[model samples]
Target: MAPSKTFFSNFRLSNIVNLLLRSLQLVDGLVVIGLYGIDLNRARKEDKYSDGKWVYAVTVGSIAAATAVVYAFVSVFMHYRSLTFLFAWDWVLMVLWAALSGIFGTMYLNEKVEMEAGIHRMKVAVGFDLAGLVLWFVTAVMGSLWFFRERWGGRISRPGKA
Candidate 1:
């Protein structure tokens, strides 16, 4: 009998982290959208900076989420040993995005607080933002370690081998 093909066959811890990252990014996007809607409904006048901040958050979250999902699928489903460069690039980009997301989330929360937005909605948004940031940070660290291992850590020569 032939062994069945399954996702677990090619799965790695990094893949799991990628999936988690994407899921958290998707949730973050949704939460940002919800916050934007609240701001729109409650605003007495247009505030470009406020609206722009939410829009930026939504855009970054969405793009990062989509990229992560696609990368996860490709990394797991495809045999791309010859594409190590691409894989490394993906990890680099994800780490950069995670850092940016964390900074943006913190700034958004601080701005919202200073604006004295509604306590209930602000609190909810803050909670979601923090959760997403934490997830992103974890994914970034995991991805970095995986990339480094692939590139450098695993290169130690065997005891007597050339």
Candidate 2:
């Protein structure tokens, strides 16, 4: 609720979540400006410059990169603390998250396949698309929670526990 007292505090897990929550405010920005530009360029205008599409892609990329960087910055700042739980699930969750995201992207692309052979009937790739999207959403949420779990000392490690 209150502003952080220092840079390190601003980089805390709760603060990271607050930053992500604030990022929701950019949804309209992405829709209006990033997804479809407001320039006077005619609607009939060819995307020769590809400005709208580029904006869309770049905006998504930037948001993802910024989120990762902010989390990394906070992790670096908290290095002195015994933030060991971060190690327990971070890499595993990160790998799974990446896999799910890749599946989502690939399925999205594959969902548009076209065919012509009469013998080769068509089938909807809807299942893959749905599964991918579901996995992506779950992975994103879990990954974020894992990233911020250390904020409350959610886990404790014994000296000999693995």
Candidate 3:
């Protein structure tokens, strides 16, 4: 039998989606980092009871961002076959990250609205959080498509047993 000329075999959609996922992951990570930094600064300056929430956001965001950056770098720079074992887990993580980011963004936006004044920095942080949520969702979707494409023998068929 000869080699198939499917999308995955020729590095077409899979490669494109992989690159897009990596780029979005990088952007999401950076945005989360920025949000964490801003939240940290705000916590330090305000010292409000609710600052603990920001601290929690920062802690979670930092870890999530770091994970995203490392994953993005590996997915982009390393050989494709070398990371095949991670495809399933990567998509799962992206979904989880998307959901968590959406929750965090909503929380921050709510907090921003509750504040009376001097919320410029918090607003910026909330904006970044929102951006991160969008990026995470897109990345998750792309990753899922790539996963299904590979699993379905690269024909873009309905997701099920081949």
- The whole-model lDDT of each prediction reads 0.57, 0.40, 0.58
| Model 2 spans > 4 angstroms off | 1-47, 79-108, 111-140, 143-162
Which predicted model would earn the best TM-score?
A: 1
Model 3 residue runs over 4 Å out of place are 1-24, 38-50, 79-117, 154-162
Which is better, 2 or 3, measured by TM-score? Answer: 3
In model 2, the worst 10-residue window by lDDT is: 117-126
Q: Better model by TM-score, 1 or 3?
A: 1
* lDDT (tens digit, per residue) of candidate 1 on 48-105: 4456655555565566556656655665675333234444544444555555456555
Candidate 1 weakest lDDT stretch, 10 residues: 79-88
lDDT of 3: 0.58
- Displacement of the residue 9 alpha carbon in candidate 2, Å: 17
Candidate 1 clash pair list: none
Global CA lDDT computed for model 1: 0.57
